[model samples]
Target: MKRRRKKRSTKQYAVIAFYEKNNRWPAPSSQNVKERHLGEWITRCRFIRNHSPEKLTEKQIQLIDRIDADKAQKKTERWMVNYEMLKDFVEKEKRWPSVNASEPEEIRLVNWCLSQRITRKNTPKSKLNKEHIKLLDDIGFHWSSNNKRRTWKESFNLVKDYYARTGQWPAHTRDPEESRLAKWCSKMRAYKNRTDTSVTLSPGQIKKLSNLGFDWTNSQENNRRSPENTNRIWIERYHHFCEFTTNNKRYPKAKSGDPQEESLYSWWMRMAYLKRKGKLSNERIHLLDCIGFRWGKGNE
Candidate 1:
């Protein structure tokens, strides 16, 4: 029997190629399935290298290190790299990394922070080092999703000032501050809708907002073209058409060049088409019939 060498899989080759092209490791959050798989594989390789070095062959270990330099580092060293990156970002930005951060580096830091929070909540205490948690705490990291820097009272006052200055509620605008207020208002509405007793709007907050004539529906229902409004508009137009017919003793000419007459002519044609298709309601048909309205092209 002849000895044969094991071949590297396509994924291994592809991941190496990807790292070479991008100059960065693929992220698990990548939308592309292949890239996501490569990212997850890299994560596993890093973990295995740190915990069970005997599981991976020397050649495989070298390949992973070539693609992901961090794989050569111990887990604690990797953790420090992420922690320093985040700490530097927070020091510069004066805030935690936002999930909505536009930069790839900031987004990576945000995800790293999120993972730490998840680990604190779900992972057993025995598996975690308290020193890491203490380091994060020293930097004012928020373990909860409510990571906003502003207090509720300050936000409420800001909204009041915004309404007073603009003479309208905070709208989602291009200005970052205004947009933040708009998001806060939207969040308040969402909290109000939540059935969970723990997620609730304070009675005082609700009263304060209500006094500002804030619509809790957060909708333009008054301006919406509802079915009832449409029906009323249709009837009003019909009356206008009837008056035109009675005065001229003829249907409005399609090419009359007068805007009102041309509009009525178009409306009449549409109604005729609807009646032919049996789409016009019986009540509307009776209304037209009472006014001796013709449903065919013969009248035109």
Candidate 2:
């Protein structure tokens, strides 16, 4: 034979109703269950104020308190994850979860939720005991798991790891995996100064890199394919172009991924700007003309 569930009392429903009506909880001495006089229960009551409120007897109140206290103690026993979040998970998935949970820590919680469905269509929130929540909480019970919730140092290390693997600091790349590293670069730049993904170098960053044994070099090539709304990155590229001319003894061509190409593109644009303002001289123009540098609107 199936066991019968205990029936709830009218006074128990009244307590819930009163809490819903009044935002704050009432004091134990505020009122009775049916707004009745408590003196009828005890003869010549000298201290009626010390008696149980909610119209329940003293023994019944003690039993409820002991039961709740015992449940709370067992719920918190060797558990760390928030029990409320687990309840929220169960409420969303009409049926209980199976074993294949995405997170390893969530697997046990899913199993606990599955176990709650003894024979019901869904395990109601009221049906969940402290033991059920406690089992889920234990899965995330280590101090090491709590460590990830605090620091961003691990996120910063992603860029450092990329730099180590490639022997170069990650640039603003759109190449799927490299682009993810570029995000870290952008974040670090934004955190330090309100800059974009250019990841410019500073004296402090240089010092930090040196201490970390990272050899960050400013190379004479750009990752920017076209000359857009940027100046500093192109300036570095121009500097590298000048170095390339001296060392390679040849003019740098437009290499798809090379630091050069359409290379002196922005440098030429800057020169044109200075020329329009009469700041550029005929001497400088004549010199670049020798290296086959393109001038005018469409990269000449």
Listed per candidate, the RMSD to the true structure in angstroms reads 26.7, 32.1
Q: Deviation in angstroms for 234 in model 2?
A: 8.7
Show model 1 residue runs off by greater than 4 Å. Answer: 1-8, 32-58, 61-118, 134-300
Lowest summed lDDT window (length 10), candidate 1: 1-10
lDDT of each: 0.68, 0.43
Over 1-300, each residue of candidate 1 has an lDDT whose tens digit, in order, gives: 112113234556777788789876775445566776566555555445544667666766787667544543556798999999999988998898765554667766765785687567645577667999999999988878554687676577666655644445666643355578888887887778773355688899888887876756667343234464456457557756765675466788777745457668888988999999999999678667645577766865
Which pairs clash in model 1? none
TM, every model: 0.30, 0.22
Candidate 2 Cα outliers beyond 4 Å, as residue runs: 1-182, 192-267, 277-286
| Clash pairs (backbone) in predicted model 2 | 220-240, 221-259, 222-259, 254-261
lDDT of 2 by residue, 220-278 (tens): 14422233213224333444544454444444454444323343544556676877798
